[model samples]
Target: MTGLSPVFPEAVLWDMDGTLLDTEPIWDEAMDALAARHGVPMTPQLRRATLGNNSVDALTKVYDAARLPESGRDFDADEAWMVAMVVKLFARELPWRPGAVALLDLVAAAEIPMVLVTNTMREVADIAIETIGAHRFVATVCGDEVAVGKPAPDIYLRAAEIVGAAPGDCLAIEDSPTGAAAAHAAGVPNLVVPSQIPVAAASKRVFRQTLAGLTVDDLARLFAQARTDTPA
Candidate 1:
């Protein structure tokens, strides 16, 4: 038994953007504006590549796509601009993902600690947190606070450390391939609820069409199944 639940996972690590909230379209708008500012359009391919990317990485990709001179690029300035634009869009209305609120309530009722683990910077993520209610999380770990973002284990590892749980003992809820890959690299089993793009099947990963009507027991089952599916 872990915490108040008779399950292997002691805590839940949640992704913010597409997992808990429908903020991807907001990001699309901001990234499109950014691409236009750089004298290029936001192609479907570029948008897909930037999904789940941190500010720095996404900005770099945008610059590359624009064919901008590397010597003339200002990473810090561009990152600030992007975050500002996203924050402006986020301010309008932050919508929750389907069943996200209900599932959060169920998990809280079970007395399991939850942490917000996102590749978004604190400035931008705080707005979404407000919509989701900061009271629901025990901690919030962001990309700017870590040495590296998703697709690397640093963010997930840091989140686990904050909650004092081993990676394998934590269940991650992710919606993007980048986030799932990070959790997998950290040895954490994740329940993948794809929001925009399809995530390929892999060890320590389980899929769900949506979070609608998911129960606490389902979480336990998913965690156990991922552990079982993983190689010893």
Candidate 2:
């Protein structure tokens, strides 16, 4: 909280998994189970590679790591298994990242339009949204709905469109490098709050330790700083 008056962006684009929810460990657990099914261990490198990936891409990485032949792989079945596993785990509980609830509360109070942009498929994203309260967002753009997921800018672009905001007028809040890269590619400045992994500094990316006590004014300042720092 600051004395500075609030300066709101046209809209806010939010990353779901590692950003708003503490679901990375749940994904890791599911991935480990998937590896076991493949008769392979989920090594650290493999888990790292899968972070921030969509179900299909993450499965592909795991299969590649397992050294399984492409012809032997059953992607459709494996993807179903992975998503089911995660869904079951997600049903148990969806924890919020520190201060996430507060920030969402603040944003809602400000009456700022928010959109969820996630690499998670619609099936699972819908579940998470239910837990987070779907009414909070004007709309949601999932990986399955788009031709490609994060690191592609498609999801972010779509989210902005849904909010009726230009990319430059919106602020993207992300946790992973993959999500940050997508926001950057969309030419949308971001407030990066790294969750599971470190994100590299970029021209329009502002790093923060946590979202706790962050006021709308802080968001405005961060957005403005990113816009100014970004290369013309």
- Quantify how close model 1 is to the true structure by its C-alpha RMSD in Å: 2.7
- Give stretches of model 1 more than 4 Å off: 1-8, 230-232
The candidate scoring highest on TM-score is 1
lDDT of 1 by residue, 64-92 (tens): 99988989689988888888888889999
With a 3 Å backbone cut-off (N, CA, C), the pairs that clash in candidate 2 are: none
Best by lDDT: 1
Local accuracy of candidate 2 as per-residue lDDT tens digits, 6-54: 5678999999998899999998899899999988899887887778987
In model 1, which residue pairs have backbone atoms overlapping below 3 Å? none
What's the number of clashes in each of the models? Answer: 0, 0
User: How many clashes in candidate 1?
Assistant: 0
Per-residue error (Å), model 1, residue 130: 1.0
lDDT of each: 0.91, 0.88
- The TM-score measured for candidate 2 stands at 0.94
